[model samples]
Target chain A: MRALTWQGVNELSVETVPDPTVQSPTDMLVRVVRTVSCGSDLHLLGGYIPFMRAGDVIGHEFVGEVVEVGADVRRHRVGDRVVMSSFIACGRCWYCRHEEFSLCDNTNTNPAITEALWGFSPGGCFGYSHAMGGNAGSHAEYVRVPMADHTAFTIPDAVSYERALFASDSVATAWTGVELGGVAPGDVVAIWGAGAVGQMAARVAQLVGAERVLVIDRVPERLEQVRRYVGAETIDYSTQHVGSELLEATGGRGPDVCIEAVGMEAHAPGPDFLYDQVKQQLRLQTDRPTALREAVYQCRKGGTVFVLGVFAGVVDKFPVGAMMNKGLTVRGAQMHGPRYIPRILERMERGEIVTEHLATHVMPLEEAPHGYELFKDKKDGCVRAVFTP
Target chain B: MDGSARWTAALVGALGIGGASVAATRAVQKARPRPRPDRWHAVTVDRAPADLQGVAAAPPEPLAALGDDLEIDLRPAPGDRGTELRARARRPGLLVDADVRDALRRSRSLLEVGEVVQPDEPGTTRRTVTSLPLELAIRHGREGGRL
Candidate 1:
């Protein structure tokens, strides 16, 4: 089977690998139909995540048809069209019981790796580096899905495969941000980065009754998409002062909730950008928190700041005083995909969310490297690149 | 001695007997059978193949030869992803109908939701723990991925 393997920094190749077989009674084998490139993949591609190896397959968000089911997999049958949550959960742990699916104690087969990193380990995530369980990614003809009953959902007939693909990760991720930030009626929500996740976050905020939603980015097309498709105000940070503009728009109160959808490798303007760049290059800091810092700085006092961007390591010069003195609340999570993907699917069915536009470029799985390049460079307004196997 | 002295001596003797009776009752309670923290499993470091030993909750030597419906527990070290088995289990295994690990995991599901529930197909992966950097801050951030 041909799969995209991560060779090294900025290197991706579609190589032939052995096809996956079901190894557990609770496992199912899925022939992938569509797998999409994620912005988080950029962190892995850039060598920011150190756990990635030369032959590791890379992709997470995907939808497919169940070709085989293990003996214990009761919920799904062969030929079922399913969308798998990026995060693999046991669906039996204490955390899963409380709907904290990502934090499931049993699913991370490589708990020590994550336990060494995060105190305890989180549930396994597909193709997200060894830190997230090192499960083979979905960017292949067939991949084995462990704990299939809860991690993979049968897509409703009303939802298209393209839209269902987003529900696997992007939509659920944005919904997790909204759910965590507690977007409320009449609240102003500001999201940093107008990429796929941020775009979805903006729409989700509106769907949840946020009165005003602002998306900030320097990319013209992305800002335009946010304005048009997502129905949110846009801010070109390169042109206007994001903080001042947000403050003025909110009548000086600042956005009630600020979501930082841009992660560690953010490109920021000014002297601090250079500071973070040098530090990042020298390996002195693991992440560049320009957008996160700005989110904390620009949020209204006592408001919440939800970080949706992936930060693999520590950041330098976090404004603890601002976070403390202003009585700000900070929270973040890997998307509890299994918990929220169903709700996202319901919303998608109701026509409250449309995702076909996010798949700006569609290509064969063999051309995955090109997809990555176009997405990394933001070429052709490619918010997401969906690949068919 | 006067009547007052006699009365005081009687009172002191009665108090002594009362104290001894209380102490005796506590001793009897202590001697009665009480539950020890259930050690249904014990940890060992011996390198062993669990599948070869079958489902014996007890150590190989004692329970290996006896096959009267057994249960076992072979797990990875608490924080170490199953690089090596933690070498644990109990003897006179719990009357379970499945492998010890599966039984415990299933029982957990049943207790939590009244049925064994799963999100994905249950399958096994080779337990390989590659040597990676183990900085607390590095691993901690990966938990509950903030992004």
Candidate 2:
């Protein structure tokens, strides 16, 4: 099988790897039809995440067809077109019972333990790294999926793989963020990071009946895309203060709900000396506190703040006092991709959510590294990239 | 002897009865459990991947003793062995020896590391001792007994 592997920082290559096969009773071997590079893939290439080794498959979020299934995989069978969740879950744990698949008790993709299990990890992304369950990614000709019945959802024929791909992660993550933010009908919502996830969050917010949606980002093209496709009011953080813009957009009351989709590598200008210190710290306090802190401070009293970004290590200096003083409710989670995949697929079938617009580029699997670079650099209006295997 | 002696004996008997009654009341009072004080401290730590650049370190002072009643500790990785903190209070008639442990078994941050500490043993003095991964232990110490 051919797949894209991370060689090192800023290094990637298309290499031939062994074909994937069933490894567990709950496993399924999917013949990948389409997969895409996520914004998070940039972290692996930039060496932001440790233990990502040479030749580690790097991609997550895809739609494919099950060519084989293990005996215990009763939910799906051969020839069933499906979209996979980014995280592999057991689906029967206490957390899964509550639809918190990301916190499954039996799963190995957890951030803390993944490094020991695999060379690298990314919250259990497909085709990303070994640390993320090391299950071959969907970027290859064939990929093995563990806990198949729990992680893979059948995609209806009415939905195209291109449209269903985002359901695997970006759309699901955005929906998770919006849901966590407690977005209600007629509520004013603000989203930080107008990337694929942010855009999808805006779209989902509208679907869930948000009265108004505002998106913030520095990329002019992405901001424009949000305005044109998502119908969201946009603020270029590069040119203006996001908090002030959100406040103005919400008539000075601030948004009732705010979502941070940028994750750990969120860009903020500061002294170069602070960069290393900031990168090593991963708590909610110091990791990209600007947008999140602004969200906390600017949220309407008694509103909710949802953080969907991936922060590593410890965080410092969170605005805890303000969160308490304003009576703001803050909640966060890695997307329970398995739980949301089915729902997002149904919405896609109804044409309620248009994911195709989010895919700005598509290429063969061999060019996967280039796709990562383009998406990372935000070049050529690269909001999302799809890889056809 | 005389009528006066007889009267003194009778009064002494009555005083003995009163003393017995007081002693029984004190014993019952001592047997009852003491009410626990309302004291809490909020603690939070990052549970993200370790390799990512800019991953924040645990607080310089992770442990804190708040208001002389509550203590908190935060760490980087709560670890496989799990971690715990002990909290205690003093009250009359309480066993004061019973240990009280509140196991934070279902924390998202704790992951597989179960039981922040075994649930507090009852009847002990009010003192909270938290045991977590080394990073959090140090962090708690640096926080000066505040969350």
Candidate 3:
């Protein structure tokens, strides 16, 4: 099996690895048809995330055909077209029952010890770092999916794999942010960082009937794309102040909801400051204070702020006072792809939300490293880069 | 001096007692206050520093600085002024002006304590400083600044 592995910082290699097989009664083997690079994957490439070792398969968002199923896998059968969730969760766990699949008791990626009989220390992830349950990822010809009944959703015949591919992570992540932000009819929503997640979030906001959706990003082309396809108002943070623009657009009231989509490797405005200095000196490659600070400063009072972006480590100088004084509601979690995939697929099938626009480029799996580079550089209008296995 | 006089007197007394009881009940109800939709109201404060300061006191001068074309008006309360802000901008409307107010307010706070400032806006950006014994809020006109 050919898979893209993380060799080191700024190093990704596509090599022939052993094919995956069903290891547990709950496991299933998927022959991947399509996979997309996640914005979070940039953390691995930049070495921002911890414990990402060499030869670790590096992908989490993909659609595949189930080639084999385990004894306990009842919901899906062989040859079923399915989109696998990024996280592997036992549907029977307390957390899974609550739809908090990221925190599922029996499903961490870290190796389990006797003391932790059921749950692994690292949360289960497809191709994320070892810190996230170091299970085999989907960026290969074949990958094993644990908790197969809970994690993989069979796509309807009408829905194309190209559209359903994002259902696993990018679209689901945006849906998570939208749900957390509590978008409603006639509400004004602002999303920071017009990456794939941000674009999808803007679309979701529209689908939920947000009266006005404002997407902020420094990239002009991406903003234009969002405006055209997602029907969202774009704000070039490079030219305008995001916080002020949001207030202006919302009539001196900041957005009723704000979503921070630019996670850990978010670019800082201007040169390195004290916080940047500390991070640089500490050899930390991740942390973006500007975006989070702006989100806090720009969110409306009594409104919800959802953090969907991945943050690698500690963040300093967070504005806890503003959050407290304004009576704002802040919530964040990893996207429960298993929970959202079905809803996103339904929306996609209805043509209410288009995931196809998000795919800027598609290439063979052999060009996986190049795809990673393009996405990391954010060049060539790389909103999303898909690799076909 | 007979049965008719006694009946009238009893009826008058009964009416007086019933009226007094009704008045007492009304007073109690007024004192306790029942939940009503009209009574339930919420005031949202925008996280922008300028708006926060404006609601705390008077509107800032930067807001007032917006020009007349912007149609900047200040309403006391419970008016649809906020709605007007959204309707005004079609193609890059009042968004720039609002941003300027936020920038001015941010810059003012940075200047108040005599801190060396790196201007958010490039070149020699100008600001009119007014010092009061305490903080005096001033409102800006729409389309007022060089934004």
Candidate 4:
């Protein structure tokens, strides 16, 4: 099977790799139909994560057809059109029982690495680095999905494959942010970054009844998308002061919830950005937390700040004093697909949430390396690059 | 070498290099784990302490996977966490920490979820020069975590 593989830092190639097979009773083989690039993929491509290996297939958000199943797979059969969650989880674990599927105890085959790094491993992620779980990603013709019954969902007839693909990760991740950030009816929400995840977070906040939302970004294309498609006000941080615009939007009380969707590889504004970049390059800090710091510092007193970004390790300047003085709540997590995916799919089927517009560039799997180039550079207004195998 | 042998050799080589880098660069979890003295491998399962001790009679695969010369004890965890299953080798040199930790983890998962979920085998990589360290950490990782 041909798959897009991570070759090295800032390197990718489409290579002929071994086809996957179902090895566990709860496992099923997914014939990849559409796999797309994500902002999180940039960390891997840039070698910020440090766990990636050459020849490891690289893709996660996808919609596919079930081509095979193991004996204990009771929920799905071959030929079923499905969307797979990026996170692999066993439905029977204590975390899964509590709807925190990302924290499942049994899924990450390589637990010690993360347990040693972050004190405990979360769960296995497809094509994510080995630190999460060294599962093969979906950037191939076929992918073996573990715990298929819990991780893969059947797409509704009303939902197109393109629309359902986002539900596998982005929309679910966005929903995790807004829902866990505790967005309430009529509350004001401010989101950092206007990428696909940020736009989806704005949409989820609106769906959950946040009356006013503001999306901040420097990219003119993304901010335009936020205003037009996401129906949120935009702040081009490159042009206007983000703090001033946020204050004006919320009428002085500040946003009730501030969500940071930009991860470690954030582009900072000026000299301070270089400070973080240098520290990160020097291995002093594994992440650049410029957006995260802004989210924490600018959030309203007693408000909630939710992190929806992919951060690897320590950062230089996090605003702990501001958080402590302001009495704010801070939280973050990987998406719990089963907890939010069904409703997201239902919304997609009903045309309540539309994501086809996010696929700015669509091409064959062979063009994945170029696609990554376009996405990593944020060129050609490429919100996301969708691939067909 | 045939394909399988080449792949295995490459993976082992990567693990070797990665193991050394993991110790040097990461600055924690010595690439080589020294078994702690008088330390017991323990897991807190959602099941009751009594149920875990009783399961040893008709041992599950997780417990059975460990040899017969193991001494096991179960007690309620503090703060209502769950039952704590503690075990150690009956003899001085029977099992290493990794073996005991791995067995305890499997036993807890088997009792709690009925089966230990795993990643796909024959996986997706051929193990590259750069992929070695993370690969090695993962290879030795099944023994729970630093905790």
Candidate 5:
């Protein structure tokens, strides 16, 4: 089987690897149909997480066909078309029962690695580095999905694989932030980063009745996409003052919900960008909190700030004083995919969630390196690169 | 000449006493290995205390593998948490922290999820020179958190 592997920092190669088998009682083998690249993958590609090993398969968001199922898998037949959540979870765990599927107690095989880092390890996530669970990623000819009853869901007949693929991670992640941030009807929502996840967050905010959805990004095309397709206002942070703009947009009150979708490796303008870059390169900080600090400072007093971006470790220059004095509630998590994927798929089927446009570049899995180059560099307006194995 | 001969004999006698004392100490140490930390390793299972009553006596296969070398205790966790399964090695043979934690973690998974989830089997990762250290770390890293 051919799969894209992480060779080193920013080095990806499509290699022929042995095919996966249904290894566990609840495992299921899925033949890849469509897999997409994510903004977060850039961090893995850049070696920010440090858990990725050479030759490790890299991909997560995907829709596929079930090739085989273990005896304990009670989900679907072998031929069923399904969209899998990037995060693998056991359906029977206490966390799964509480709809916190990402925090499953039984999935992460290498828990000690993340346990030492994050206190408690989250569930296994495919192609997400060893810390998230060293499970083989979905960007392969085939992948073995464990505990499939919860991890993979049957794609609705009306939904295309391209549309359902985003539900695997992007849309579900956006919904996670929107709900967790407690975006209320008629409340204003401001989101940082106009990538696929940020676009989805804006759309989700509107779907959940946020009166005003504003997406901030330095990218012209992404801001355009947010305005035209997602029907959200755009803030070109490269030119405008984010704090002043956010305050002005909300009539001096600021947005009720502020979401930072940009992760540790962010592109910020001016002197802080250079400072963060130098600090990150020097290993003085594990993550950059430029967007996070801005979110905390710009959010309305007593508002909620939800972090959807993936951060590996501690950050410097976090606005602790503003976060405290402003009566803010800051929360972040790896997406609880199962809790929201179903609803997202249903919405997709109804033509409410349009994600096909996010696939700016489509190519074979062999061209994954080039696709990632376009994506990582944000060249050719590559919001996401969809792959077919 | 007599004084020199006496000094040499005394030196040999001192070395002999020291060697004998070292051998005796090693023999005693071998009879009883050093103890690990006295802290009890515990996991809170979602199952009620009633289900875990007398669990130490019967014990699951994980704890049972340690046999009498491990001591087991079960108590109800406060505020509807669950049963707390606590264990500590009795004489430190196979119940090292890593092994004990893995066993306890597997016990929790087995009881909760009905089975332990396997990681990617027949791992497809082709070994590179850089990957060896991560693989080495993973071999010793089964205990999820509290590791």
Candidate 6:
């Protein structure tokens, strides 16, 4: 099987890799159909995620067909078209029972590493990194899905494979962000980053009764997509001041809720950006929280700030005082796919949300390295690059 | 027969039947123990010629073919730290040594899952030679429910 692997920082190659098989009782061997690049994958490509190893196949947001199943895999059968919840969740665990599938107890096969880093291990995920369970990613001809009955969902006939693929990670993550923000009727929601997740977050905010939404980004292409797909107001932070503009737009109250979709690799506006960059390069800080700082700083007092971005390791210069003084609530989570996948699929079927624009480029699996390059550099107006095997 | 005597006889018969059934079930289980899955062995080799620059790096094979059922992986550890070998058994009862089997299970859980899940709370990752009563008390204090 040929799969895209992380060779080093800024280095990716489509290499021949061993085919994946069912490894556990609840495992499913799925033939990869479509795997796409994600904004978060850029962190791995840029060496921000420390756990990635050379030759580790990279991809998580994908849709596939079940080609084989373990004896205990009862829910899915061979030839079933399925979309996997990027997170590996055991359905019977305590967290899963409560619908917090990302905190599942039994899936993170490598708990000690996370326990050492984060004090507790979260659910295992496909091909993110070893720290996230190191499950083979779906960028190949076939990938193994553990706890398949709980982690993989059958796509409804009404939903196309391209739209269903977003349900696997991007849409679910954005939905979780919207839920965490606690968007309400007539509320004004502000979203940072007009990338795939941010665009989806904006759409979900509207669906959840947020009357007015604003998407902030510097990229003209993404901001245009946000306007076309989500119908939300756009803010080009590079041209205009973000905080003052957000304050003025919300009638000086600021956005009722702020969503940070930009992860640790965010680009800051000026001199401060260089400080974070140098410190990050010096291994002084594991993440650059430029957008996070803005989200916290610019959020309305007594409002919620939802973090949908991926942050690995420690961060410095967090605005805790502002968060405390303003009575702001902060919430974050990895994509709890089981909690959101079904509902998002139903929304797609009902035509409440359309995600066809997310995949701007489609190519063969051999072009995955180039796909990553285009996505990482935000070149050629590529919102996302989907690869077919 | 007296009424009391008849009731007592019925109670005794019920107890005898229950005891006999339990004993028979235990005897059957002892006669045929449930089979255990075949445990494959795995180990880490600290390959030489290690250098910070231009290391002999290879991609981690997330999945490898060991047999029709078994899957194996040989990947460079995180950051090209070292090489790790992981193998799994498809069938029950392989010829791997007992100590090697336990080590493989522990390492595989760490490599695949992230942690070696403990059966109960109050259990330490450390190997302890504490008394049984202390261990039981610790487990009981942590959580009363059976894991």
Q: Which candidate is the best by lDDT?
A: 5
Chain A only: TM-score per candidate: 0.99, 0.91, 0.94, 0.99, 0.99, 0.98
Residue-level lDDT tens digits of model 2 in A1-389:
78777665698888887666665566788888989888777766775564354566767788788899988779897999998888777665446656888765444433333322222222345655433434455667777787778888999899998899899999999989988778999999988888899999999999999999988888998898898888888888778887777777878898999898877667754553265345545322324455676678788988999998765444555789989999999998889997788889899999988878788999999887788878888889898878898
List candidate 5 segments past 4 Å from native.
Answer: B1-36, B91-94, B144-147
Q: Sorted by lDDT, highest first, which candidate order results?
A: 5, 4, 1, 6, 3, 2
- Name model 4 segments beyond 4 Å from true: B1-36, B48-53, B77-82, B91-94
Across A1-389, the per-residue lDDT of candidate 4 in tens digits comes to 89899887898999987778777778899899999999999999988988877778888899999999989888899999999989977887667878888888888878888887788779889999888887888888899998899999999888899999999999999999999999999999999989999999999999999999999899999999998998899899989998988888888889999999999988878987999999998888999999999999889999999999999889987889999999999999999988999999999988889999999999999999999889988899988999999
lDDT of 3 by residue, A321-378 (tens): 9999999998887887878889888988888878887889899999988987788788
- The local distance difference test score of each candidate is 0.78, 0.66, 0.69, 0.86, 0.87, 0.76
CAPRI grade, predicted model 5: acceptable
Rank order by TM-score, top first? 4, 5, 1, 6, 3, 2
Q: Candidate 2: global Cα-lDDT?
A: 0.66
Q: B57-102 in candidate 3: lDDT tens per residue?
A: 3333443344332333223333321211111222344345344434
lDDT of 1 by residue, B1-147 (tens): 897786576567545645664686578658986423233423222223443243334434333432444444555434422212222234433333223333343333333333332322222122112212222322332222211
Model 3 achieves a DockQ score of 0.01
| Candidate with best DockQ | 4
The weakest ten consecutive residues by lDDT in model 3 chain A span A111-120
List the lowest-lDDT window of 10 residues for candidate 6 chain B. B119-128
Superposed on all Cα atoms, the candidates' RMSDs to the truth, in angstroms, are 18.8, 21.8, 29.3, 4.3, 10.9, 22.4
What does candidate 5's lDDT look like per residue over A1-389, in tens digits? 99999987889999998888887788899999999999889999987887888778989999999999999888788999999989988877667878888998788888888887777878999899888888888789999988999999999899999889999999999999999989999999999999999999999999999999999999999998998889999999889888888888899999999999999988788889889999998878988888888889889999999999999998889998988999999999889999999999899989999998899999999999999999999999989999999
Worst 10 residues of 5 chain A by lDDT: A89-98
- Judging by lDDT, tell me the better candidate of 4 and 6: 4
**B1-147 per-residue lDDT for model 4 (tens digits):** 997887788778667756765566556445557656566778778766666667656656666677686777777888656778788888767877788888888887788867776766666567565464566567787875663
Tens digits of per-residue lDDT, candidate 1, A268-380, equal 88999999999998878989999999999999999999999998878999999999999999999989998888888898889899999889999999999999999999998
The interface RMSD values of the models, given in order, are: 10.4, 18.9, 27.7, 2.0, 2.0, 15.6
- Please give the TM-score of chain B in predicted model 2: 0.23
For all candidates, state DockQ relative to the true structure. Answer: 0.03, 0.01, 0.01, 0.56, 0.41, 0.02
